[model samples]
Target: LLTPGLRGSKAPAGQNENLQGLKEKLCLMGDANSKNYRPACSLCPVNWKWFGGDTCFYFSEKEATWQESEDDCFSHNASLLMLKRKSKLISISQISQKRSYWIGLSYGVDGWSWIDDTKLSTKRMDWIDLSSKQNCAYLFYRKSRVYSENCYEKYPWICEKAAVQLI
Candidate 1:
């Protein structure tokens, strides 16, 4: 099947039918003015990750340090998961079962904050106390909880961006 946005100069017979099927299975088209309409759709192409809701998540299988993971996500025009809402956090936790992954939270001179510089809200976080030396935060998939770890430690990471429409 042809991947989205990779259409050839000429489609073989029945290609239009196949494309329709692909769209029905893999894409969710929302009203242009709806809250679900995402700006990222203009830039995203086929093979991009698509999760339900307004955000798309990319779970990296390769392990890397927290900084490295952040860089990788940046390269993809995304950031490590910020998880602003408790419901979003819980949904991500459920989807990432049993596989701890680096998130966007970290500690710096200013104190704990997301990579975007937003302060980490204790009221919304599910933190597990760890050693003072562990300054980076990760999602502990087994229990769907957040925990601190050394920033240099290598682990798989999750990247998130606004959901996009497949061209």
Candidate 2:
């Protein structure tokens, strides 16, 4: 099967299909850190300097409301709560144990979308269920790492400043 945005002149016959199958297989195994989660400092794909915790501080910027937090991330050309890998999720849980922080999740456009405008579409990816939604944004606590929150709530947050690299 040919996947959209995967066709190229150099691609071998059936190569894209095989690749897609492999990707689906991996996704079915849950995230990388499903069994045990941990926290650590690392660079995020969207360019935010991540410090494993419940909240990541941006230089001198202090905490703010969920909307304000989202705006702050946007000012830096980044978004809050975009996890590129499972280890990052573990780190987030290890970083802080408090009220849930706001993420880039929103209920505007289609049913829901990321702050970066990416549509929420994933069959293998798992999300933390909080109040009454399956596709809402995610927040991390020192003890747990998946929970939903109202986008208008005030909470300390972490935002991705830029993309260091794209995979």
TM-scores vs. true structure, each candidate:
0.69, 0.52
Go through the candidates in order and give the clash count of each: 2, 5
* Regions of candidate 2 where Cα sits further than 4 Å from its true position: 1-63, 97-99, 130-138, 163-167
Best by lDDT: 1
What Cα-based lDDT does every candidate model obtain? 0.75, 0.54
Instruction: Write one digit per residue (lDDT tens) for candidate 2, span 45-160.
Output: 43234453333334223557667777777776656777545676666656544656666666664766667777656544464444566445557565455566665555777675
Overall local distance difference test of candidate 1? 0.75
Measured with C-alpha atoms, the lDDT of residue 123 in candidate 2 is 48
Cα miss at 39, model 1 (Å)? 14
The TM-score of candidate 2 is 0.52
